[model samples]
Target: MKISTTAQAGALESNDVLVTVMPNDQGGVQIQLETKRVIFKQFGKQIEEVVRGKVSEMDVDDVIIKVQDKGALNYTIRARVQTALERALASGTRD
Candidate 1:
């Protein structure tokens, strides 16, 4: 799925994560992740892998993704990214 506009999901609350998806003019998936842990360098890779997998499964290409993790699990991150992508796709169709 192609992202036609910017969309986001989830919250900053503990055990939750916020995911944002936006159109990328340069093409390809770009991911930015923020977390409070000092081990973000490691967790960031894990988070990126999860988002990349989901976007690939959804057949999405050329978009920017931003993730804010508040102690959320891998599954939660995946769900939030999926939700954001879906919302982006839905909004695109409505436009």
Candidate 2:
């Protein structure tokens, strides 16, 4: 059972490549993603880690993620990236 967090509106830019993929730890992976034009610079890594670690195909490709980014942080770079994956997994959507 995959689940998403409250970080949906985190994306600030209209179109960009912001995504992080990784594996889930709990019984099921939980995705936590968000985006902003300028979130705290410190949070960028947290976002990246979420993406890199949670976006790959694990034991079951069942993973979770949270993307919150702004133009300032590399973290902002992957918000949409994650979203794209989510869309694909959910409805076979594409960029």
Candidate 3:
């Protein structure tokens, strides 16, 4: 799916993650992650893996994903990313 505009899901609350999806005309998946320094040091790779895995599973070739995590679990992160991707796909022109 192609992301035609910016869309987001989830929030900044504890145990939640905010996922934002945007069109990436340059191609390929790009991710911008935000979290506490400590959390990044500990779970940064895992969080990124979750995002990339989900995007790949959904068959999206190009997108810009921004993740703001507030100690969310992997499932929460995946769900938020999926929701945001769905929204972006729905709003985009058909491929």
lDDT of 3 by residue, 1-93 (tens): 677788999999999999999989999999999999999999999999999999999998789999999999999999999999998888776
Model 3 worst lDDT run, 10 consecutive residues: 86-95
Tens-place lDDT digits, model 2, residues 1-95:
23232223243455443444444556554555454535435455565564555354322245555453434344444445455555545442221
User: What CA RMSD would you report for each candidate?
Assistant: 1.1, 9.8, 1.6
The CA root-mean-square deviation of candidate 1, after full C-alpha superposition on the true structure, stands at 1.1
Error in Å for residue 65 of model 3: 0.3
Clashes of each: 1, 25, 0
lDDT of 1 by residue, 1-95 (tens): 68898999999999999999999999999998889767486677888899999999999999999998888898998899999999999999997
Which ranges of candidate 1 are over 4 A from the true structure?
none
If the candidates were sorted by their lDDT against the true structure, best first, what order would they fall in?
3, 1, 2
Better of 2 and 3 by TM-score: 3
Superposed Cα deviation of residue 83, candidate 3 (Å)? 0.3
Model 3, stretches more than 4 Å misplaced? 93-95
